[model samples]
Target: MLQHLLRLSYPTPADHLDPEDHFSTALGTIFSDDLANQHGDRDALITYLPSTYPAYPAVELRLADPAGEDERRKFAHYLWNAGVLMAELWWLGREEEHKWRVKGHAVLELGAGVGLAGIMSVLAGAEEVVISDYPAPEILQNLRSNVERNVPSQLRPKVRVEGHTWGDVTSPFPAANAGKFSRILAADCLWMPHEHANLARSMRHFLSPDEDARVLVIAGFHTGRARMAAFFDVVGDEGLEVEEMFEMDAEGKRREWRSERDGGAEDHGERKKWLVLARLKRKTSINSGSA
Candidate 1:
């Protein structure tokens, strides 16, 4: 089954707008002792997941000057983990040749918090990749820096990184990006309860006209299954389809751990990750046989 990731804010009888969507800083915030403990035991400089060979160096997403450095670090750290985990799973699916079938094609990524998917696409052989975020100038600046900092000069292809708000249509895309791109990738971008409409609109804009254009998305369960249903409804209304899905093990970790408490502690609904391969539907040509 195709699972819906990050559907925590789908509409109900009385759904109110979430201020975080509008007023939250470009670098969001989070503070949890559990996350901090995880960071401390490991090298804060860089780390890579075990599965990906010739492993890519890790990058941390940090909150920009929040009330306290401690609080800001938590949010930034988890955001990076989300991106890394998503990329790792996608790469695992394509490990047969250690390259992507969509290589050498134009690519675009939305809501790229730490640029993991875009970076991975380049590593997998994209001709040119554009990393886009919200219009917030500062946040966009950070995204650009990460693309440059983390992307090794040798492996980096012709890449352009920039920020674009969800609803803005006039923003400039790469010349080849006018209607090109064999692949479109995103992860953990659907969580904003209040921004589903805006997100749907943006996906339609950046999505390619080729009905077979490849799109691989991995999203975690944010607000449980109800919220996910709403996101799927939005996607269906916009003419996209979810092709496949996977779920993580208990404790929100990507892999299973052998521990006694895990036996009955798992909530089947919240432990899954939705991996979707979707594409935009092409409009019928007036002279086509079907038409």
Candidate 2:
């Protein structure tokens, strides 16, 4: 029994196939010092290890998701292989305005698929971070466990995680979150056109109206420019102003591309635009008296 308890093991990269093979292969292609060569100083943006497995397999089943531990384990490997979470970590670590260095700012993260961006923000020094997504039982269960697993010992005590469903307008913000967040963040969340209205409304309801507040949206422009333009257009009419927008290339360098809404287009449409950072500002209340 003692020996069994002491046994430790983790699967190798070649051991499993993700549901999306291409994404998994692409992730394997980008490992290790490759990131340093790819992004230069920005290499510090993500933390990647040769093998995510423990040095020796020790029994720490507590880290496993009780509800869907198997499913969560598979998804974790897939996410690692595709470098999906790494992408968010890389983008959020930058010290620029779009980055998570907004310390002392209370933040809410929507559509926190796997909770990467929110966790990264806490690492990047926000005062408080809340990670939220739809309340589907399985997803929420895995989300809670993942947050518990990844919350750094140094930072765990500072971060919080909870369930939020964008589709439910009547569902109140978690009491701990009500009117408290000064910044809202979303990454790679606009790809689902079906969720656009709900995502936009959720943003409007929670984003702080204080002039100094900011809502940053970071997404990979894999779906083409037209759809991206339309999403922002719908949100614009609701008073979320796009303060600044910039495109980032595969290597994570800023590049020049005409925003479709701005009547601009990239001269060469070959390279993939891996990221877009949009800072959203809420409209000031005209109905309120000035200080």
- Best lDDT among the predictions, by candidate number: 2
lDDT for 51 (candidate 1) = 46
Model 2 scores worst on lDDT over the 10 consecutive residues at: 36-45
User: Which stretches in model 1 have alpha-carbon errors above 4 Å?
Assistant: 1-46, 55-81, 90-102, 154-157, 174-178, 246-291
Total clashing pairs for each candidate? 6, 2
lDDT, candidate 2, 1-291, per-residue tens = 001111122233533544454343344246432221111010011233212234312112111222455434322211211123222333434465344345677878876655655665675677888877665565556556666666667877777667786745465554334446677887666756666777776776676656667777776555556565566776765556677777665445666544563354633233233456677766554211211
| Local accuracy of candidate 1 as per-residue lDDT tens digits, 19-43 | 4532322122242211211111111
Residue pairs with backbone overlap in model 1: 7-227, 7-228, 8-223, 61-76, 247-272, 247-273
Q: Cα miss at 156, model 1 (Å)?
A: 4.3
Clashes of 1: 6
Q: Estimate each model's TM-score.
A: 0.62, 0.66
Location of the lowest summed lDDT over 10 successive residues in candidate 1: 1-10
Each prediction's whole-model lDDT (CA)? 0.49, 0.52
